[model samples]
Target chain A: MFNFEITALGNMFFGLTVLVFVSLFFVPNKHRSVTLYSLLFASLACIFYASDLITLFIGWEIMGWSSYFLIAKTADKQTLQKYIVFNIGGAFTLLGAIILIYGACGSFVYSELDFSAVPSGQVTAITILLLLTLFVKSGIMPFHYWVVDSYSQSNDLFSAVLSAIISKTGVFAFILIFFQIITVQYLQTPILEVVAWLGVLTSIIATFKAINEDEAKRLLAYSSIAQVGYIVTILSIMGSLSLEAALYHTVIHTFVKLLLFINVAAIIYVSKQHRFSTLGGLLYKYPLNFILLVVGIISLAGMPPLGGFSSKFLIYTALLEEHKGLLLAAVLFSSASAFLYCYKLVYGIYLGQPTNPKTEAYPRIPLRFYVPQILGAVILITLGTIPGVIVPMFNGILGSVGFEPVLYRGVFVLGSDFASFNGGVVIGAFGLIFVLILLFFVRLKNRSVKPKDRLDISYCGEVPRADVNLHYGYGMGRELSRIGLIKMILSRSSHALWQRVSTLFGDLSGITQKLYTLSAQNMGLVIFAFFTILLYMGVK
Target chain B: MQKGFVAYNNEQKSLEAETEGIKNSQTLIQKAMNWFSARSMFVVAYGTGCGAIEMPPVFTSRYDIERLGVVGVATPRQADIMIVSGYCSLKTLRRVIRTYEQMSEPKYVIALGSCTINGGMYWDSYNTIKKLEEYIGVDMYVAGCMPRPEALIEGFVKLQESIRNNTIQPGYVKYREDYAYYQANQEKLLGKETQPVYEEDYAGMNLS
Candidate 1:
């Protein structure tokens, strides 16, 4: 039987997917088949619009397979294997959870589930399985081994879809299941707290990884992981404010990634360079593209007079409401460090002197590329100027999901009981100051001269030869390793963390022995008494 | 050979003599601009020899040249003044020329110590250039074997007075008009082009 229903959360996600798909028309897909691409999109729709567990699973699997095929075209054997193994493993866990739910409830339909009949222990097991699946899909750490390889190795445009659209499906699934179907009251608070910490930790680690990466796409891939980590962290709070913040971030991140990826794609289109060391000083060469990238980065960093700040403001307020001071501190620390990578992304690509001489003659970007960038840029600016415009939509989602609507009022000004700011005033002030400075400089009698040659920079009176490693994109995050705590975070991979979990199981019996010894004097008697009791039990 | 800047300076001075100090032949706006430029000087002092040792005492809290509005900047492009601090060797002369060319117009140069004036210690050495003037224009010279920080301060004060009063020829104007002469001298000594040189009056000098 086919049962289809629509919800406010699904509609928002589906809308974003459509916006992403609209940009793809500009990109010429030369792949072996339009069939695979269509399948991917159709499956995405299925997942977003699915009414029951079965329908969702069917869509999820199709999306997975189709994307694997798409990525297989560009990615190497090892990357493909990594992609399939992790995704298949996640898919199996999802299937296992669905089967268990069906067995327990005797139905797969959304409205038909009766958790009252299910055993509490079985429900906890179900929760673990479901969380594991979501964690893998969203690239939460200790379960995020496959994300970076696939996103960076995939074709440029598809990687945008992977980050901006697909990764968010995991988030959609989370709300669809936890907020609507299962609800959070059944869940233990300790589980959610651990999830929140996992998310923030993921972001902090992924940020450092992003900065350490040299290849452009790989760095963006790491950045994508870090951003999704923030959403997951905030979502775990399960408050209306947290949900609004997560949704706002989701919307902003979609447009920001679309803008950045398309901008990078356009750069790669002309320059044929992928590494930051090879791509520098494109600011003048592609002025419009550079400005768009700057806009994207400004939003990415959550600065004021940009849409990013609005969501970040909401996220912090939500955390503060919960009195999650330690978690908020960690989240803030990660976000502050994020500025370094954001700067690296911009400076590595656009600002510095071009490492290659041929970069000067790189071809003009196609008009099609600007279509998505302009669309993204306009939306971002509008959101920054009038962030309150989308609140009613968010309020509608919250209402449909059975929660209280937040107190954000009006289009130009965002006001709540806790915090408020006028977007128009922030933008107006910024514009006025910029104009004043520009006018002052332009009216000066003594004009500032730029030397005709790019190599005219003073280098302690010595001229730099053409081959010097001027752009240190590879070395951007290397300094962080010198710090003690960061060094520990940077050295361990997700695989290492998982490996430790297995080792923990092997040490369980050994842990029992240590558990019995409370003090140094008791330790000697405890060990002797334990051995005697074991020997007496063995004889009996 | 004072045709370019010094002659220009005299024309303005005579015009000022008639206006007599109150108006001083300059518009109020022009006078204001001159006053601002003289008050804030960013210096790029290239330390090629012994005089380099004396700059720290001048710059640090002990002497604090910042009160006089003469601050040291790292790059030539940001600097309004360049001090050829001591003896200019053949190798050092090339960089100094390159840096001088990079600085914008309204720039001045101070050739420090007797070494730059007449090559005090390195005078008889093969690599040293004796007179700083032939290679590039010298706006003011603080004369000593290793000029005292006080002497250097005096040189800056004198330069600032000339800048504020609009009386003396700034070196950049002279370099622009007589670039060919400087380039020819540089090419004869260094045996290479130090920087990009556009077409100008040759000031044809026989290098040999």
Candidate 2:
């Protein structure tokens, strides 16, 4: 009998147990919870590394249940209940896939199971089922409705952990499916191509939704889906380079998202403003924090020299290498469209005028605030600069997955024929040169000119009124919507779909809940009607 | 297996060393080494409510917020702008007040979404506050239930307008005045007074 490794399973169990306890604390003081959650995540990573199917299944269930509870801590009772139901459904599907594999091969161990021995149809079914389960967890399109409600509703700290670690269980599942179950012949079908297309579609739709979103946390939730779409598109390429790029993106994304979420929490914690309409002109007040947040946002946006660009570049190269023209164009368009949202984030909060005159005083940011994000930002920049350091480790991972090794050629330059500097060297040199220029500028400036608060000039003869309420809203996406042709495709709103679904489910559940309260005779009559209907159908 | 462990351990140490080289450190040697590293500014990670939807692009690859000096800060003390995106519930208001209290002074508040201003669709809802002025003051309001990212961008520009104008300043005196008016009004209007759960009164409590 194939048995789960007790050690690995226990690790997952420990993580889940810890998460349950961690959910009890409040924000800004959830350092204890963060510590425990980190431990739990570590345990999970180990279980995934262990890699026996039974062990994997155990770890999977543990991670799902743990994260479900994490979502529960901040979500309303209804949303939490829905989150649990959706998660359980995904978990059960995963269990079924494992059972099917065992039934076919008479083994649950991942290494010994031979996918080639199984029929192509069965393999396809298993792959699809597994993908469904993972997609549900990863917040892929059509299956992603629960994420925003769950994440946005949850406590800020809980949201950070959920976004960072829990959602990634799907990526781990994808890894297993790509390497262990599906072969190249199977992946070459139009089905994989369809999956890639779906990712592109999801990204486009989710980005627009994010652009128009008002709730800060909800916007992040939608952004999470968009980022996941990028990963899905790359992973569906089924090439070694693409897979590696996907991994890179996943790693970078996890940390960047964590930083972003925590930063959101810090803002909410300090400012007492959860809506952007009421917040502005904080950059001057909290210069240190503004700078740190900029680091996180830049890294997230895939700016050149930050961690985001590295992964995006890799994914683009992989797509180009495969000569997937349409996908490349979609990526390009998506990349260009990203600017609108990024500028919104920057200009919306810090760069604008202060409408609320009372918020001029800067509140204290806790020491813990800087520690985690600083560490994350550092890691992102480091990875972006010197990817070669991690190349060997990825190579080992590729070996384990039975993929060929690949190298990262640095950015290139055109010469008489062809000449290129390594990306690391070229980027590193420019970065150095830029830093030198900035330093020179800083040094050249007169120290005697003590910087004072800069204000807007009152133009003309008119005295500027303080209460005109300066803010930019409603017009953020007008240009992009009109210009990008996204208006046609992204017109389908998730909120509308979910609203309809919630209404339907609300009615169905209402009826079901009242079913048992009926008299015994009534219940019997209902059962009789059901049976009669089934019999009539069978007979027909 | 032991050899594999050793090799992995060695690799890990080297990675840490290289990482430390690029990271911000106080030591002179470390600073000298980091001169070549790319400089990035901080951004306050403030999400009000629905308006927060626009933040992803700024932080993500499309807009690349790093070219500018903005980054996401994780705490109130470090943050510069507090971006409130949309509407606020009574439940959320309590936390928001506490968070605002925690942030270091010289902070900014950017309110995103129309709900934060006049409560939008939730204006009549008992749970939501119609006038944000009644509670914590706001700096900039990006008007929309969910404002577009471009609107948020424009809001940021407007916020910059205020900041450069030197019009933005702490208004604790106004809050104090409003609080006093609120207290007196509550006593007169409601007869029995119920203090705000989030804020503290300057005068001593009525023990009797």
Candidate 3:
């Protein structure tokens, strides 16, 4: 039925190849495995172009299992088990929902499935199931336990792949469900609204955890959760442009995470340290890696002239369109939280004084590692400079999904009918201003300013100790954890309160366990009492 | 019945009953004295182990032996109170020393639920302490773990009922002599030689 079947099959093979390769990374003969992983990754790029759901699912499941095995290969048995269980749970839910849809419409074909025929209840159920599956994969809150366990435990290289390639499966699933299957016009439930709120909550909670987490890998894992939360929120907007925003965001986040994780991995591999508390003053030691990390972190922080800003700006526009004032406020709050963690990630690792005095030479990264990171940075910068090229392809996808694709006029006007950003004007002004500043700085440069043995960072009278490590720990989020009404609304302390309620259950279960141990007849009596209560309620 | 109710017989019966009551009263007084002597006071040390390190400083010779009339008692039956200092680790948590039973009337409890107040440094630590009061009831947490010796003394001074009504008959041998149970648990959690290097008397030694 489709000429793209070869592409689909090739992609599926590549996905499997990547999975197999990544799984075997710990083996002594790892070069062949890396080759296989790259081959699979290349094939997956083809799979992304699949014409139908069947082919898509093949690629999808292959990607899922391959990543799962890869993650499993990296983690301990307990974490791997949780990773498998959580992923399988999501996959099965997705499979069941697909089956239900096929049963309702009597087709496996994505192009053939009619949206109008799906009964409201069935549609709602399918949406919920799909959303749940996707949320689990994305590592959204409450469902995020597997993410940290898997990401933090994985080999550093594999951690890069997991953060980049694997979690994007959630975004793919979201596109399929939110765009292809469900019509945005079917006005019924507050499901999307709930998702938006969930995103905000997820960001807040994950950021707090990220702030507290001592392990570098775990911190990155929490950060990934926070980013995915933003993506999910944008997708839930269900606007044509928001789809573009989501896709752009996915691309940006993937590259940024890949870059950051690789840089961190390089740092760890060189220093044999994984905790931020132990890592400091590396800017002087590993200048190139440090620069790469800064680029990645700044992009992650959504600073202007980077990839994060453009996509985030689109999401904000969508929110403004919907007049979601509170959500807009939350978006800003989460962004500020991003700044807090970003500062810690940079200042804690490189800017602060070295705690350990026994200095070691910095290890050079294999060209293989730096290439991918450099490619990612280049893509990020190019995307910021010229958003024109990919905007059309995303428009096509969103248009097919039944949302009006925004047509850009050189990254300024939308659809030739409306106006937005004026890239020419802004870029020209920015370039002129930059040149002037550079000229002034060059002219004002002072040769007399010599390098000091020690730099003063703090205002206190005590001279900056070369050995004392300055760490901004979990206490940074203390301001947000207010004891008042806001905390009552957003905090999960209620889950802890439920522990008290469960204590009652614990008491009851304990008594019951003891009673059953003492006599089976006592259990029979209990069952009889339960039936008696049921009978009484039935009569009433 | 009418014959038994004669007036002279009734008067004789009343006199005999009064004499029997007086004898019963004397026996009751003797029993009360014996019960008083037999009563052993039960105090929940609520020591929470690491903070229990500072207890010797207050009880030993350098701090003066008995100004407050309170001595560290081992068994709950021989103790009248509990002092919770900072941090409770999960492994050493069993010996927190809270008991609802065997305590005499007018018992008091203080909460140390903040790492026993709000899980201070131990909040994020999984294997460390949690809400201490949620398990064994505490009476007047001494606030800080390794609280200043002054604060520990202050807590003791505040607990006067425990001082004045010293009904607890502590076995001085057990209270003042042995430290096996505490040592074993400590050794189990942290192997032998893990007791901090600095002794209480070492003023010049640098401790991190």
Candidate 4:
């Protein structure tokens, strides 16, 4: 059956995709193809609008393989293998779920499928399979072995697209299938709790890993995983308010990641440095880019008066509504610790002393690089400034799907039964206080004498000569690795574990291939023997 | 002589006049700025000699120099004063010049002990610089073989008073007005670079 339609969820994603694609337009990449990118955009649209499982599955595989080729342009053989194997494995699981649904209800269309007819055991299998696909696509942990290498190794512009848009396909798929199609009653509460804990734990571990990383893109890749982890956690709550929280966080995260990846791209473009140790003192050299990066990190860290904090607030309130006290405490702990990596990101590139004298000659960031960052900053601030406006839109999203708006009361306040605050007053107060402090500092003295040179630091009665690596970028987070639990978390390699898994699968395939290499008579004898053994067991 | 030096001298003289005019006028804003800058002193936490041992007691709860609004900062960028805690060997002298230059303007130096004043016990030593002022500016001096924390505190208080009252030309200003004299003296002892050269230059280019 061919089926297609549009819903509020589709519209939100369409708008986001447009925003991302426009920003992606400004990025320069040698491997970029207009035709291929258009194919990707069209396939995503198909997935968003498809009303049938087969149509959705077709779109999903197309998106997967197309992005694989895109990543293949820059990635080495190992990275390419990881990318394809993990993505195709995810696709296969999705296909399994679809096949199960068809066999149970005998329908591929969402409106025609009757889930009640399916046995409880079969339904749980479908849920697990669907969740597996979604986790792999979303780069959720245990399934996230492919994400870091692919994101970091991909071409600079493509990395932005990967983090900002491609990874969110799983989130959209989860909302569409789990919320719209499947009734939540079939899912066990314990399973949802496990998922929620998995998400929060992934975030905590990723934050520490980000701090430990020296490569700029790798750090951002870990940061992307961590931010997406929050969305996954909130969605596991599966309430109407929680749905709103997930969508809200998704919007904020998409913009934040887009801004951050592009900013890093600009840095890479000029300085030609990948590791934080090689990059420093570019703050003044590229002041606008630095400011934009700070804006991105502020939002990424979920600080107040940025759009990041707004979504984070919604997530907390949604959890509180469910009385997930312990889960909320863990979420709070992760958010607090994220500040360390955020500081590390800024300090490594911008704040410290420049180790290279040639940083003075680094080219200015092109005007096009500013386009997306400024757009992102403007939107985030506007969202933060008018916090009440988006709530009604989230409410409208529920109404569009014929879902009841049981809880939403007003524009600013959330969770009437639980704690709520007027967001307008909070934002206004913060804005006013910020202005006052800024004015006080600016009105003071204006006698800042520049140092003789960059190397003129207080080095215990000796000058740091030009050749010494004065930049603290490499050593900034080496302290946290000394701590007990974080050290354990950072030291464990998921990639190595997955490597053993791949090797085992390789050996299994080798044995099967040897069975086929036998002559025709041998193959026939093997089949006959297998059937005879099966028949004897049946008779018994 | 280069006309550039004459032009620089003229600019420097007018700048000094402007500072003097500001000092004489002493508007409420200027006074407020001076008072705050003098009251909240950030001493660069570096030590060259034996007097460094006496610093912890002053900074910590023992002598509690923090009561007088003087606190030690980790870097020269944020520091208002650098305490040359003891005698400077040629090695330490290079660092002192670098640190003093790095400090932001309206900065001062406190030469601690007789070592910095006239080389003290290191007067006859080959490596020691006899007078610290030849290499960098010294705003105040506490001239004991090993000055106690109380004497160091007194030196800080007196320096703060002089800064607040505008009663003396600050050493930072003097350094700025007469940089050539200091650099020449430093080069005489420290060779042409006036910076510690290591690591990068150690390998002979003839390695190939």
Report lDDT (CA) for all predictions: 0.83, 0.64, 0.62, 0.82
Runs of candidate 3 exceeding 4 Å displacement? A1-60, A411-419, A422-435, A445-448, A455-467, A470-540, B1-208
Clash pairs (backbone) in predicted model 4 = A461-B95, A462-B95
lDDT of 4 by residue, A219-313 (tens): 99998888888888999999877888888888888899889888999888888888888888778788888998999998989887788887888
Off by over 4 Å in 1: A495-540, B1-23, B197-208
**Model 3, residue A369: what's the lDDT?**
59
**lDDT at position A525, candidate 2:** 95
Against the hidden reference, what TM-scores do the models get?
Answer: 0.88, 0.63, 0.60, 0.86
Which stretches in model 2 have alpha-carbon errors above 4 Å? A1-27, A30-43, A408-421, A432-455, A458-462, A473-475, A481-484, A488-491, A498-540, B1-208
Q: What is the interface RMSD of each candidate, in Å?
A: 3.2, 17.7, 24.0, 8.0
Reference-based lDDT, residue A324, model 2? 93
Residues A31-67, candidate 1: write the lDDT tens digits: 5357887898899889988899989999889988899
Better of 1 and 2 by DockQ: 1
Q: Model 1 misses residue A77 by how many Å?
A: 1.6
| lDDT, model 2, position A523 | 82
Residue ranges of candidate 4 with Cα displaced over 4 Å? A355-358, A406-428, A516-540, B1-46, B51-74, B77-81, B104-108, B144-179, B195-208
lDDT of 3 by residue, A383-426 (tens): 66567755776666665566677757366332223225644444
In angstroms, how far off is A35's CA in candidate 4? 2.9
Tell me the deviation in Å of residue A171 in model 2: 1.0
Error of 1 at A48 (Å): 0.8
